[model samples]
Target: MKQFIQGIKDGGAIGIGYLSVSFTFGLAAVSSGLQWWEALLVSMMNLTSAGQFAGITIMAAAGTYIEMALSQFVINLRYALMSISLSQKVDKDFRAGRKMLLGFAVTDEIFAVAMSREGEVSSQYFAGLAVLPYLGWTGGTLAGAVCGNILPKTVTDALGLAIYGMFIAIIVPAMKKDSRILKITLLAVAFSFIVYYLPGLRNISSGFAVIICAVAASAIGAVCFPMEEEQEGA
Candidate 1:
């Protein structure tokens, strides 16, 4: 119980950090003509900043459902990898159902904090840690949606760029540490478009194309930039 409380306290930072970015998501959703409840629902349910933004971007563009799914998969692939790493650090006794539920809380910040703990993490601690952050994210989105109605059109228009700003905020710091990420990301984006241009490839389903591009890019990255230093903790 104490650990749970402590986890919640730690999670306050994650919640606070999410406020501004999730707020931008809300604004973007409204700008794209979605209802406030829909924006809130997205934040409350999805909890993925990049994936949700990409999805809304596709919707605004009148893109097909396949396009939206593919774009989200490409943009959010890192989370799947994150969940894998986090699973190793979690309590071995955690039930399958518990692990699955906790998996939803494995945002970048939560994963970092949970992994930094001194020993195997308990479900209680994780629960405490996840709840506040989830609330903060959804609350921020609702606030932004409400603000969207009253804020000047010019200001709301500029907030549209806020979505990109969220992307930059997440990417820039990581890019500084590993230049390879930028290269791989660019490679993935470039190759992922093949299904649109090549006649034979154009016949491929968007989901398959997305899977191929992401898997190939990740494989090449794993081979080319083997993480010896990170693994060795050097």
Candidate 2:
């Protein structure tokens, strides 16, 4: 019970951070022609800022279902990896079905908080970690969607970068601690730019472009920056 309480406390910061970013997403969605309720629904169902942004961009552009599905898949591939890593941190006796449900809420912030916990994590703790962020994200989206055009352009533009700020806060500290992480991060950036600007590739659909960049970057990291497992007793 103490641990579960701690989990909710830990998630407080994440919830606050998500509120602004997801609010921008709601505004963007409506600006892209989604009904206000539709924007809130997307936030509630998807709970992924990047994937939702890409999917909505495609929808606004009249992209196909294949494009939406594939784009979301490519963007959310990291969550799958995050979920697998989190499963290893959970208590052995935790129920499988419960863990599967927890996996649904495994955003980057939630995964980081859960993994940083001092001991084996309980499903209850994980649930506490996920709930507030879910409310903040969904509620913020509803607010933004309702206020879509009312917010000034400059304010919305600034809010749109909140997610990038959140990512930087996560990545910068990790990169400072590990050179390998820095290298992989730089490689992903360079690889993405190439995909975006390069000839022929520039013409690729958004979904395929994301898939190609993500897969290529990950493959490069796996081969060039593989982690060496620590020995049982160094």
Tens-place lDDT per residue, model 1, 1-234, is: 998999999999999989988888888899877889989998888898878887777777677787877777777777888788777887877678998888888788888899899999888899999988999899999998888877888988887888878878876776666678877766777888765798878876555576688788878988987776365211
Which digits, one per residue and each the tens of the lDDT, describe model 2 over residues 1-234?
A: 876787788889999998988887788887777899999899998898888887777887788788788888877988888888887889976788997677789898888889888888898889889888999999989988888767677765665565456557756897787777777777777877888898987878766766677677768877886756542110
Candidate 2 backbone collisions, by pair: none
| Whole-structure CA lDDT of model 2 | 0.80
The worst-scoring run of ten residues by lDDT in candidate 1 lies at 225-234
Misplaced by over 4 Å in model 2 are 1-3, 151-203, 228-234
Candidate number with greatest TM-score: 1
Whose lDDT is greatest here?
1
**Over all chains combined, what TM-score does candidate 1 have?**
0.81
CA lDDT scores, all candidates in order: 0.82, 0.80
Backbone collisions counted per model = 0, 0
Error of 1 at 60 (Å): 1.2
In model 1, state the lDDT of residue 180: 81
